[model samples]
Target: MDFVEQERMAHGIPSQGKITITVDEYSSNPTQAFTHYNINQSRFQPPHVHMVDPIPYDTPKPAGHTRFVCVSDTHSRTDGIQMPYGDILLHTGDFTELGLPTEVKKFNDWLGTLPYEYKIVIAGNHELTFDKDFIAELVKQDYYRFPSVSKLKPEDFDNVQSLLTNCIYVQDSEVTVKGFQIYGTPWCTIESIPSRCITALYDNCSAQDRKKLRRVVNTAQRITQTNLPSIDSVYTSRCLRQAANIIEDPSHPGHSLFSPLPSGRKSLCLKARTTTLKDSFYPAVIRLLNGPCIH
Candidate 1:
């Protein structure tokens, strides 16, 4: 493929209005099959790209007509509590525990049965196994297991595919729905490998395993890298020593900003509040849009 064709392929774009190519009937090439099918049997519709009218910087806030319900980190606890009804149901992350086949089936079953018109879901750290590549492979193979060469179970892959069929799974991407630009990320602080049974869960750093994990880490870092530095890094650098000294002068109110901990620690004050680990936004949206409560 030339540069233009390679660029198109990189973005999964169709070249020109139409393109034609011939291939042998016995060809087992997946790309060839897709291209061939697209050339004849498939009809491609150009995306609808609408331009929104620009609003003045000082324009007044629009009337609060639309309600948005956000939920996150459900981790496969659907039936434990009733969901609040809303125009949109947003489940932010950790849709299932371990991202297992059975868990996904139950999660999808519950999500599909919801009364909300729009249901959006995102994956979280616990769903480490449910990456886009894994999901795509599962879908392509009709949720079957890899042959003896790979140990990934059939049930696991199939379940992921099944769940994806009904719900929108956002990876390192964004979707526009009802004037909102929704971006999703499934990342969290890395946990120490607690168990060795599932190699995916922990770092079993053999030469091959190191290569695999390094690739995964590098890809993830590039995908989520941002131009801005964190507040701590910007403030504590040696290059900012003069500025830091000025800011931390005795007369400065910021002098105590980085002071050592007090001799006696204070006890944490506990409040009686409903704590939600996942889908925290879903219920809030339901309460706002579908009235204070869905149940």
Candidate 2:
């Protein structure tokens, strides 16, 4: 069997590939539990809400919180620096080279060992496993495409979850950790050449619609349909007590909520209490096949 055929059999997914959705099952306490399906936001709508929600006010703040480490673009390169320690670890995307089972397993294995109360992972352009359906289809026809990828399978979803016991995978969803309200999304506009998954914008539309397509594509310039938020939109600590209506739980560790940071501010320091624990996060990093970051 060729590489494609061998790979097809190995994962039990079709040669054309498949799409997998992972819902995080969270339980703050035993009785109250919910499964979050927000990570797959771009593909599906929220069960009820039609519009994206404003970052909820009265967002909780878990007491005795600490540091948060944000990293991105590992590209199967987790061996370099010793990961920084924080209370929460946040990864943006590009978790794998081809989203192959082995690669995913390897990355997950590393992620699992990290010690943190909470870990958040969002998909990135390099995650080939996110589009398995396309790969399976190609293989069935015996026309193999290299570097083009596949999505996760139902069977493998558990594997992903198992690897990150403390992780909350957010596609287009939010999670409350310690006291922070974290929203995760694995989306960027960079195109993957052989991978139809990344070039999705052009896949369905026609050349005549290129202009329209450009707007829809996951380019860095326009990462999402909704524009990025502004810093003032978030409730930072300059007015914490008064902003209780804006923060969820202001006392928890790593209690972060996402809104836009100011134009020049690197990060917003929300008041309440500083979370000092050292946590490390791996964000999604795009791997270019031939060109610059795609739009």
Candidate 3:
């Protein structure tokens, strides 16, 4: 409702020492659902993409075609949502309410039910618990802003990343699934989130981890998720442009940065080494698209 509330919820700050799941918003009409980003679908010319009905569950896909389902910013409110079938499930970020262990377990339980062969996930800005360094820094460093945040104990959130047992949790790392080099990271540019107070990933990463961080753009056969803060439409395109300018590269075709709202496709590109798509980070229904990959 208010900017303070939005900021608070975005950071998973508890209202009264307890975090609650926010309702996920979905775009009723399909087109506007893609808020604004730099990824152009025309470049790859996907074989086909069926968004509205999702071709029904367990439907057949063409041979050599791999369907990828991308979703983000669910915020731990996936109770009634209907899921589509795909070979790989790429959840960009924000799957939990507060990145709490209980919330992570709930999200993990849902992941367990999914029939997808591979499920890859990365944390979003909302994953306050998973970004334990951010929490420690907040409690120790920031002076004026984190009055409530300073109250959070680092021990409660330590090893929070471990709760994600059901899916491949990748932060500044890569996992090769079915020959596709899928890398996931929560690294946000200072330009992307200018208001950011804590340097989460940059401060936490080791010297070696920083090396992998630099390689993010160059190493993606398919880099699945990026959580960019939602700006109004007038600024969305510009913000996305700023992000793409840094992430996109003409030399390496495999590097693409995709995130929900902030994020799919069929036949996507049989040989499309690098592809980018933007889905509205808020809505879940319209956010569901087939990420077409091959086996």
Best by TM-score: 3
The CA lDDT at 11 in model 2 is 41
TM-score of 2: 0.40
lDDT by residue for model 1 over 1-295, one digit each (tens)?
3434443443467655434444455254332343344443345322232233544433433233333567777787878656654566778877776576667778888887877667777877566357646545545555434332134554556446446655666766888776667786665321112111222222223456545645554564465452322222322232234334544588865444333224322211222245441123222222222233212
The TM-scores of all predictions, comma-separated, are 0.40, 0.40, 0.47
Tens digit per residue, CA lDDT, model 3, 1-295: 3333443444466444434554324223212324322146454322332134335656766544567888999999989888777799999998976676678889999999888999999998878777766678667865475455556676677888887888999998999887678888896542344223212223334567556544543343134344333323323344334435533564444233233231223213222222222222111112222333233
Better of 2 and 3 by TM-score: 3
Sort all candidates by lDDT, best to worst.
3, 1, 2
Model 2 weakest 10-residue run by lDDT: 278-287
* Residue 105, model 3: Cα distance from true site in angstroms: 1.7
Candidate 1 local lDDT, residue 113: 84
Candidate 1 weakest ten by summed lDDT: 189-198
| Models sorted by TM-score, best on top | 3, 2, 1
Q: Model 3 — TM-score against the truth?
A: 0.47
